[model samples]
Each structure stands twice: as C-alpha cells, then as structure tokens.
Target: MEAKQFQLAEELRKSIRGIVKTDEPMAKHTTFGIGGPADLYIEPADTDDLAQIIVWLNERQIPWFVLGDGANVLVADKGIRGAVIHMGKPFRKVKIDGEKVIVGSAAKLDKVVSATVDAGLAGLESTAGIPGTIGGAIVMNAGTYRGQIGDVTEKVCVVTTDGVQLEMTPENLQFRYRWSVFQEDKNKIIVEAYLGLKPGNKEELVRTMEYIRHRRNMNLPTVGRSAGCMFKNPDGYSAGQLIDEAGLKGTSIGDAVVADKHANFILNIGKASATEVKELAERVRGTIKGKFDIDLEYEVRIIGDW
Candidate 1:
C-alpha cells in the first residue's frame, strides 16, 4: 500500500498541474499543531484543476480528504495513508455584488464577515469571529447564538459525489444543527458559494462584530494549540457547562488538558500528541455521561489511521 501510494503520488505530481508535496507534515497545517504527515498533499491551481484531479483520483480509488483552513480537525499521529487536498490561501477570493457576496469556498469565514461588514452588509455580522474556511463552515453549518452560515447561503457550487461539478440551490441542501448534506456524502467538495445579505448601518455592524470578537476572545482559546471545541451541545445542554459541572476542567493527559477557562476546549500546552487529545476528550465524555446520562458527540473532526 505504501509503494502504491508513492507511485500514485508520482503520477499525481506528473499529471496534475498544481502544487504537490509528499510526506507533508500535517502538524504544520492543523491548528492543534500535532500530527505525523500526509502521504500526498495537493493544492489544485483552480476549480478546473481541482475537478480534473478529483475525477482522476476517484477513478483510481485512491483515498483522499479535502481540508480547509485546518481549524476543526485533529490529524492522527500515524498520518494519512492517501492524499490530502488543502484548500487555503491560494484559492480564497471574495467579491461583493450589491447586497450579495460571492466567495470562494476556501475564503476564511471570519475574513468574509469582516469584508461584508466593511461593505455595510448585515447578515454575516453574527459570524464575525468564527474561524476556518468558508467551505468547512458550510459543511458544518457553522454558527453561534447569532446565526448559521447556512441561513444566508443563496447558492453553493461543488464537485458532487460522482465527481461532477454543479451549482446547487440552498433548498437542495438539507442543513440542520451542525450538519449538512456534505456530511452525509463525504465526497462532495464545496468550491464556491453565494450569500444574500442586507444593507445596514456601518457603525452598527462594526459594533456588533466587535462585540462578537470580544466574546470569542473571552470564551475561546485565544492563544494555544487547540481545535476550538471538542464536543457538541447535546440538545438542550451546553457541553462546556456540562463538563464544568462534572468537574473535569483542567484535566490533563500527557500534554493535553481540558481548558480551565473554557471546559469544551482541550489545549496542547506543550508538545501534545493526537492520542493525548483524544484520550482527554474521551475522559471528559465518560465523566459527563456517568453523571448526566448524556452522550457527548465530538464537534472536532478526527482524521487519519487511528
């Protein structure tokens, strides 16, 4: 399998007219700063290049994962055996048309919020401080108390399950709490999206964004190697509150620890491994379940051979 993966990487490097790296360190890409390496790392030049590469890879049955800004994932220490397509800076593009913002899927959600707010757009102010790329945000229906990204989505352009490119309407995408059609079919790759926003007073929008930013700074891990939240809010309960009540805050496993400031976050204080992070999260889950009989589902996506 290793030999075949190497051969596939060679072929991919030769055929795809894009950036390619073998044994690329996943730690460098992920926010957690903990991972081994990806067998093959690719950055397609554009949508045309991306479509062709996906079609080719699918035909060969070579496993692959599409990564956005690498904020919401924990890559395993053993690394990934197949390919990883990184959709980042090179692909991000945003433009405003009247009250609509047409953005590339790789554009950062927070950046989009700021840009739209600068243009006096109102709908995205609620999403001001969310991290990760727009593509990942759409896949997870990322949101806060204000609103979800799926709410303002006018259209989504993606490479479908069968490797066909299509522009789909928002209604076609059944979005629920922290879930979307993309999650149901892992093969779907978001390329771009159109958002419908409303005109607003620039000062008011700025104030709202600032408040959101400050709230995030106060609650989230502002400076640390961590993937924001470890678990999802189960129905009517907040996972952080549950964990704090369970008395698991400041719990540690190896170098990973449940943040004392925000119980939902697991921080890598210094040189933590993916195994430590997962273990600490599981311990928190077990403690919560033991006390409240509620299962804690992970919000952080775990990838690679575990």
Candidate 2:
C-alpha cells in the first residue's frame, strides 16, 4: 500500500469504533462471489461510528461506498477504490413497537419479514422473497408484483458526511419502480428505517408469504451464485420475457450463463470472472434490442473498475 492509502486506513480506524479490514477481498463480501478487493473495508459498531467514518472519508476526499448485503451489485475484477463500509452483524438490529418497526441498515430483509409475520403485522408481507438488507430494500424501493417497500415505509434514516439525516418518506423521496433518491445521490447513505404496518391475521399473512415464495421459486433463479435481476422491466414488457423471447436463455460465456429459468439472471455456473459476466450481460442486452428494438435499462448497480 502507498503511504497515502495506509494513512487513510489508519485515520478511518481511528475515527470509527469498529472492525476495519485493510485490503480485504470483496469476492467474499458480494453475493455474486466476484470482485477483486477493497482497499479498506469497514463495519461500524454503531450509528456514531458510521457517522464519524463518513465525515472522515469526506474530509480526506477519499472515495467510499456503503455496501449492504451485496445483492443487486456488480463490482469489477479490478475492485473498488478507497474504502467500503460493509453493513454487517454489528449494525443489524430490529425493534418492534406494536405496528411500527425500526430496522437497522444491516438487518436482513427475510428476517424482517419473518419478524413482522410473527408479530402479526401486515404490509411488510410484500417484501417476502426479496434478498439483501432493509437499507438496500428501502434505497431501491424493493418490491414484488403485489406490493413494494414504499407502501409501508413511513420514514427512512440516512447518514452523510454532514451528519445523520432523519425521517425521510416516499412523500419526500420519490419512489418509483425499483428506484429512490438514494440511487440519485451516492453520497447519501441509508442507515436505519421506520416502517408503519397494519394489523393482520398471522395465518393469512403466512399464506400470502407462502404464495409469494412459490411464485419466486418457480420464476427467479434462486439456486445459483448470481445477482438478482440484471435489467429493469420496460413499461409493459418484462425484461426476462424479452430475453427469453430472444432465445438467449441458457447462453454461456466462460463460466457465466444466462439462467434457463430466468433470462434476466446471469448465474455464475462455477468460477465465473467479472469480465465474462459483464460481457454476457452486454451481449444479452444487444440481442434483446436487436430483436425487439426497445432499449433495456439495467436495475443492478455496476461499480468499481470496468
């Protein structure tokens, strides 16, 4: 490491009270099981640590990314620059107060769903089958055909270099199909969340969850090492349907393959490189456009050296 990089890592560790990993392998962090490494990987112990680290990174003008459960993200083989704040066990906390639930940024979406069901709370049932953290869910307005996180999200807690920004809702943060203000501003990081839900029968909610799970099992490629959903649905057409119609399902480049079950999902069949996956994704997009004449927009965030 260079003197400047070493100093930055030292300063980051000093500023935050948490685990700080120097030159950490990002392949282990992401769900795709790809990526090279991050110069500095941090996991803040609490909200205070999270706040302090953001401030420090900004002061040094060092680039940093807030990584949640690493779903819906594609990091390059050359890796990311500066630091990566990994939201993990240290920050994963969920507090339930009647119909209101306060969830930490690192809290898993599945766990939150199960908790709400156990508590006999409705509204969060729509998030059943979605992967990744609550912070990620809120940032991307994660949802299914039945409902979205925006429907129940009362307030979103965020942190930036300036300090902690509090209580943001769909009313303030434009929620659209798989998008929110968090994507527009990389500097603003989602930390905690407050969701207001309605009361419902536990048995009914469980049934709803089961039905959603069944749909997901039959449709999405959940068995392999892959990032969920490569492209966003274009208006009336589904991206998966377009790819399947193009007959590119089960197409392969190196070890990466377009899942036969879901064309929108690029699975790492075994030991696939980032370059191969990216190339296959680009090719899939090109083929779909050539056949349909409609451009497809990517939903997953592609970061780091390309």
- Residue-wise lDDT of candidate 2 within 81-138, one digit each (tens)? 8889888887688999999999988899889999999999999888897889988887
TM-score to native of every candidate shown: 0.97, 0.96
Model 2 TM-score is 0.96
Across residues 48-156, which tens digit of lDDT does each residue of candidate 1 receive? 7788888888888878999997888999999898889988665699999999899999999999999999999899888888889999999889998689998999899
The clash numbers for all candidates, in the given order, read: 0, 0
Clash pairs (backbone) in predicted model 2: none
Where model 2 places Cα greater than 4 Å from the true spot, the runs are: 1-3
Cα lDDT computed for each candidate against the true fold: 0.89, 0.86
Q: Where is model 1 poorest over a 10-residue stretch in terms of lDDT? A: 219-228
After superposing candidate 1 on the true structure, give the runs of residues whose Cα lies further than 4 Å from its correct spot. 1-3
Task: Give residue 77's lDDT in candidate 2 (0 to 100).
Answer: 95
Largest TM-score belongs to which candidate? Answer: 1
